[model samples]
Target: MAGPPQQAEGSGSAQASGSSTARKTFELNNDVQVADPSDSLFAYSRDEERVLEDAAPWKKDPHYFHTVKISAVALIKMVTHARSGGAYEIMGVMYGKVRDGVFWIMDAAALPVQGTETRVNAGNEAFEYMVNFQTANNEVGKDEMLRGWYHSHPGYGCWLSGIDVNTQMTNQSFNDPYLAVVIDPNRTVSAGKVEIGAFRTFPEGYEAPQTSQYQSIPMDKIEDFGVHANSYYPLKVEIYKTRLDEQLLDLLWNKYWVATLSQSLISSNRAYATSQLADLGAKLHSAPLDASAKLKKKDEGVEDDATPLNQATQDSVRINTELQNGMTAQVIKEKLFNGKLDAEGARKAVLGVL
Candidate 1:
C-alpha cells in the first residue's frame, strides 16, 4: 500500500517511459469548483491534497478521464479496502481548470474500517470530518473545501444505477458540489485492470441517461510509486472510532428523538382536541346531558359565573377543539370567507394535525 504504480493518468504511458502523464504534478492553480455549488452536503477545495495510501496500479474509465484525479494515496486506499471485502470511502479533492471545463480529482483519501456490511452514503459526517481535517492542519480556505465522495459499488460494475443517482442526489442536494465514484470490486485485479467511474448529479434538462454498457476507466500502462503502508492495512483503532462517533452523532442530531418527539406531540395534541370537541358536541345534542346542565345550574344557582380569564381560556379551548372537530370555511373569489379562521390560519395550521 505504500508503493506507487508504474503508470499514471488515463493514457498507457508508464512512469519509466518518461511520458508527461506519468509525472506527478503538485502545482496548485485552478478554479476547482464542485459539480454543484448550491449543494449542502460537501464543499470542494480544488487545492487540498490527501496522502496516497497504495502502490497498486490503478485504472480509470475513459469517460472519467477529464473528470477525476486519482492521487497515489487515494488509489492505494481504494485497493486496500477492496481487497478486504469491505466498503471504502473517499474524500475526493477536486481540481478544475476553468478554461478547459474539465474536473480533476487532485486528492482522494479514506478512513479504512472493518465491518460486516459497509455503508458508504456520503452524508454530513464525512463533510465535517474532512473539513475539520483541513482546519486542524491549517489547510482551510486553501483552494477547495470538500469536493466530492467515492465509494465502492461492491461487486457491481463501474456504472451509476438509478439508486446510485438517487443516493448521489442526496449528497448533491446539500448545497455543495459533489460527485460519486463507483469502483467495481470484482473488476479490480492484478496490474492495470481496475475499472472505475465517476458521476455527478447533473442539472435539470440534461439528456436522459444511457444504460447500455458499463463505463470503464482507461489503462495506459503499469507504473510504481509510494504509499503510506499503514493505509493499506486495517485502519487504526483511533481513526475507526473517531469516524464512527462522528457518523453516529450526525445521525442522532439529524434523525432521531427530537424531531420524532416534536412531530408526535403535535399529532397527539390535535387528536385530543378533536376528540374533546366531538364529545362536547355530542353532549349538547343528548337529552340526558341537556337535563344535567339545567339541573346542575339550578341547584348550584351560580349562573355559571366564571372569571374573564377562565371564560376566555374556555372559549379559546372550545374554538381550537371545534377546529380539531373539522370546522373550516371556504375560500370565495380568492378571499377567505371566514375572517377568524383566516386571521389565525398560521397558528391553527401549526396546532392542528399535520
Candidate 2:
C-alpha cells in the first residue's frame, strides 16, 4: 500500500517482460496494460523541488520525518478508495517528493492488487500496474515520483500491523525516504475524520518510541497492532490544497453532505460490530472477570488497602467502554438522522394536499 506504511512490496518487472507477439495484441495510445513489454525502470525523480543531492542529513537523524503533507486530491482519493473496499483491505501508492523531514505527497493511486481482510501484499502484477500508472501520469504531464505506499485497516483503525512494519522495513532498507501510510475507512465514517497514519521504519536494530491509539481496533487485530507499534513512529500529517483543490473540495462536500447526514454507522460496519461482540464474548469466556474469579489465599485477600487495578481488569473496562461509545454513537446517529421521521402523523397529514 501507499505511504504511511503497511503493505507488501515486490518488483513486477520480470513478469511484465513478455513475448513481443503477446505484447502486440494489447499496445495502445494509453500506455497502461496487463504488462509492459520493455519492463522499464520507474522514473524516480526529484525534479520540481530544490535538490539536496549532496546533503544526506536524514540518514543521521532518528526522527528524520517530522511531517507528511498530502495534496487535497490525494487525501480524497485515498479515503474514497479505502472506503470502497468495505471490510476487505485495499492498497495504493503515493507520488511525491520527500524533502527534509516532510513528505510532500502530490498524488496517490490504487494498485491493481487483490487484498484480503488482514493482508495486502503487492505481487508482480501490482508492480506492473505501478510502472504503467507512473508512465501514464508522465504522459498526462504529471511527473511526481513514487514516494511511499498506503493500505487500509478497514475497521481496525489506522496503525501499522506486523506485516506492514516488515514490508516498510524491507522497502526502506533498500530505498531511503520511502514511507508507509495506513487508513481506516470504517473509523473515518464513524468519527467524521479521515483516520490515517503515516509511518517510517527505524534503521535496523534501532529501537523506537510509539501511540495513544486514535480509534478502536478489532480485538482480532490488536496483537499485530501492539507488536509493531514501536518498530516505527508516526509523522504529523497535513493536507494541502491549491485554488483548484479548494473548488473541487467544495463541490465534493456539496454532494457529500447528503450522504453524511443519511448514513447509519451500524449499517456501514455491521461486520465490525458483530466481530467485536464475538471477540468480547470469547475474551470474557476465557479470561477471569476479576480477582474474585479465582480463589485467593487468606494472606493475599486481606491486603486491606483498596486493591490497585490490575492490567486484565483495566483492559476489560477499556474494551467495554470503547464498544459502548461506538454503539452509542450509532444510536445517536439514527435518532438524529430520523428526526423528521419520528414526528407524529400531523406533519404527514399536512403534506397530503400535494
Candidate 1: tens digits of C-alpha lDDT, residues 1-354: 111222323253232332212221311232222233213112322232221101111112122213444443455566566555633333233322111223344445563333233344445665576666666534543344455556664433454545455666665556234556666553453112465666655533444444322122111100110111111111110011123443454444433323322222223345444434454454334435545676677798755443323333453464464343332211221133223455577878878966
> What's the lDDT for residue 353 in model 2?
62
Model 2 compared with the native: what TM-score? 0.68
lDDT of 2 by residue, 113-136 (tens): 789988899999999999999999
- Of candidate 1, the 10-residue stretch with the lowest lDDT total is 221-230
Q: Which candidate is the best by lDDT?
A: 2
lDDT of 1 at 286: 47
Q: What is the lDDT of residue 339 in candidate 1?
A: 36
